[model samples]
Target: MKEGNVISERFLLNNERALRLFNGYAKDLPIIDYHNHLPPQEIAENKQFVNLTEIWLKGDHYKWRGMRTLGVDENLITGTASDKEKFMAWAEVVPSTIRNPLFHWTHMELKNPFGVNSFLNKDSAMSVYKHCNELLSQDEFSTQGLLNHYKVKMVGTTDDPCDDLKWHQQLLDSSFTAKVKPSFRPDKALMIEKTQQFKQYVQALSEVSGIQIKDIESLVAALKSRVEFFAAHGCSISDHGLAALPYSYVLTDAEKREFESFLKTDGSVYSNPDAFAGYILTELSKLYHEKGWVQQFHLGAIRNNNLGMFAKLGADAGYDSIGDYKHAERMSAFFGNLSLTDQLTKTIIYNLNPADNEVFAAMTGNFADGRMKGKMQFGSGWWFLDQKDGIEKQLNTLSNLGMVSNFVGMLTDSRSFLSYSRHEYFRRILCNLFGTEMENGQLPDDEEWMGKIISDICYYNAEAYFNLK
Candidate 1:
C-alpha cells in the first residue's frame, strides 16, 4: 500500500464483500456521537480554530500523555509554547508512536477534513502545518463546520448537574442542522469524600434549586431539581464515572445522625461514604428511569494518580489509569435494585478494565429481560480501549455472551472535533470481525444479511437503542 493510503481501501476488512458493505453502507451512515466531551459552546458559536495545534493538541490528554512519554517538555506539550513550536514538537513525537493507536489516528485525521495525504512528521511538518492552517482559516473549517462536515446527526456531550446548558439551547436554535444535546454527569455530586468541594457544590446546587441541602434528603431533592432542569432541555441520558460501584448498605436516619454527632466530637470522618454514594446512585437511577432516560456507568478508572501532576495540570490531564475494582457484586446489587423497583432504565455499562470483559458481558445478559431489544448494553470499547485490538476483543466478547446484532456500537467518547473518524475506524474493525467469522465458516457467507448486521452495529442499533429519532 502507498504511504498516503495508510488506511487503505481494504484497511481492516479481510475480504472484498465486507469491504464493500463497509464502504457502501456503514462508511457514509450519519454519526450519532452518543457520548463525548466535545464542548457544546464551540458548536453554538461556530468557533474557528487559529491553527492545527490549537485544535488538535489542546485539551487532548491522550496525545499529551504520549508526548510526555517521549520526554517532550511541558512548555511544548501544554505550556506557553508557540503554536508552530508545539506543532513541530508533536510532529517530532508522531514518528515515535509507531505501534500505538495514536499513529493510525493521526494519519487518518490528517487525511480527512485537512485533505492532506502527505505523512505528518518533522520532515513534512512545515508543509502539512502551513497547508492545514490555511484550510482551518476558512469559514467551512469552524468548529460547527467540522462537525457538520463529518455528517454528525446528533451528539450527546457530557455535562455537569450545575451546567445551565445554554450552549445546547443555542445550538438547537442555530443554523446548524445537527442536534447537540447534553448527558447529565453527576460524578462530583455523588463524590462525598471531598468535604470542601462537596460543600461548595452543594451550595451551588442550593442556589440553583432553591433547596437548602442540610442533609442527604435535601441534597437528593436538589439533584432531582437539576434532573428536571436537564429534562426540560431534552436530555435523555445520564453518565457516571466511578472507580467502583458502591454497595454498602445505607444507614438509617438515626444511624446517620449518630455518626454525624460522633464526627463533631472526633473532628473528622462521617457516616460511611460508600453508603452515601450508593444511595445517591440508586436515587439517581430511579429518577433516570422515571424520566425515560438511559443511564450509563463508566467503571474502573483510577483517576488523578500523580498528585504532583494533578496539582500542576489538574484532572483529566493524563493522570488517570485503569483500576482493578471489584465490580460484579456491587453492580448486581445496584442494577438489581433498579430492576426490582421497576426503575431500571435503558442502561449501558462500560468497563475500563478489559479483564472484566466477560464479567460485564455476561452480566448484561443477566439483566436482559425480553422487554426491550437491548435494555442492557455492554457498551462499545471506550476511552483507553478505543483501538483495534480492544475493539475486536469487545466485539468478540459481546458476540459470545449476547446478541451482537442488538449491540449499540462505536462512540467517539473523545474531546476532539477531528475524532469523528473514529466511527470509520470502528466500522472497519467491525467489518473485519464479521468478515473473519464468515471466512472461518462460523457465520454464513451471506453478503446482504451480513451487510445489514454491520450497518446496524455501526449506526442503526445506536439510533434505535437511544431512540434518536
Candidate 2:
C-alpha cells in the first residue's frame, strides 16, 4: 500500500562528521563475527532457504520474544504455522517494535541484500515476502553467498569440547572464502550441577576422546586433549558461559580426596564446587594461554525463568533474563589467579546486565598487561543487552573506564543469516557517538583521527584482536 525506507544512509549518525566517517570508512570493512551461533553445516553445505521466513523467522528467538510479547500464539511464533502466516504474524508485530532496535535491524536487513526498503507492515507483507523469497532461490542468497556479500572474513561458531567439527573441517577443505572456525565452549563440562547431563556428557567425551573420564583428573586430561585437537583444526578461541566467576576456597587433603571420590561416582557434589570450578577454569586458562587462544566469558544470565516454557521449549528459546550477580570480587580473583601465574591469555568479558557495565569495564582495566593490544576487553553488549540503549551505555562506559578504541566491536550472537546488518546498525551508532562528542566540542574536531578510530573499532581492532590477517 505504501513505501518508505526508515534506515536511510544518514539514519543513526546525527552529525556531519559521523556521517562522513561511517560512509568513508566503517561501512565497507570486513566482518569478523568472532562469536555467534551460526551453524557450520549451513556454511559448509551452502544451504539454500526455501523462503524468507525460513531465514528470518525460523528459530530466531529475538523475533519470537517480540511477537510473544504482544500475545502472538505459540503456533504462529514457533509452531507448525505456514510460512506466509508466520511472515504475516511477524509483519503484524514489526510496526509495533518502534523505538526498539529490532525495528531498525529488521528494516536494515530488508533494505540490504534483499533490496526491499519499505516498512514491513501488514500491507507490505505479501510483496516483501514474494520479493525476498525470489532472492532466496538464487545462488547469491545461499549461505556462502551471503557471507561473501557481507565481506565476512571469519566466523567463530560456539562449539562443545567434544564436537568433531566435521562441518568446520569441510569448510576448511572447500574453496569457500570465509574462514569458518570453531571456538571451544566447555560450559557443560563445567556444569557439574546437572547430574544427568554431566554424566551423559562425560560418556560422550569418553567416546570422542577415547579417554575414560573416571574422575576430575581424567576429565581435565580429556578436555586438554580436545583443546589440542581443536587447535589442530585452527581454533584460536574458547568461550565460557557462567553465571559468575567461581572462587577458589582452600580445601583440606581429606576434603580433596572426598571431592575426587565423588567425581568418579554419582554422589553429593564436591563440598567446594565453586573452588573446583575455579581450579578447572584456571587450569584451562593456562592451556589457553599456552596455545595463545582468546578466552571469552559470558556472565550474568539467570536463565530459564519461565519454568512452564522452559520445560516445554528448553533454553535459549527466549526464556532467559539478566541476573543481578555480584561478580567483581570473584571475577578479580579468577583473573588474578591467571595473571599472577603469568598464564592469562587475551580475554573478553561480556556482562549481560547493563547495571554492571562500569563494573565489568573497570575489571578489564585491572589486568591490562600492555602485552596484548587490548589484553582484557569489555566485550560488546550481548543477549538481553544487545540493543541501542544497552550498546551505547556499554560503549560509553568502556570509553570512560577503559580503551574504547581497542574494543573488538559488535557481533550477531544470532542464529540467523540475515543478522549481519546488525554490524551496520552498531557502526552507525558508534560513529554517531564519536561524532556527537566532536560536535559538542568535548573532543577535538579531527575527522582523520576520528575516522581511523571508528574504522579500527569496526574492523581493524577485531582483525588484530583475533589475529585474523
Give candidate 1's whole-model lDDT: 0.87
lDDT of 1 by residue, 300-368 (tens): 999999999989989989889999989999989888877886888999999998999999999998887
The global C-alpha lDDT for each of the candidates, from Candidate 1 onward, is 0.87, 0.88
Worst 10 residues of 2 by lDDT: 247-256
Q: What residue runs in model 1 are displaced by over 4 Å at the alpha carbon? A: 1-3, 255-268
Clashes of each: 0, 0
Across residues 64-114, which tens digit of lDDT does each residue of candidate 2 receive?
Answer: 999999889999987889988999999988989998877988999998888
- The parts of candidate 2 lying over 4 Å away from their true place are 1-3, 249-252, 263-268
Indicate the residue-level lDDT of 120 in model 1: 81
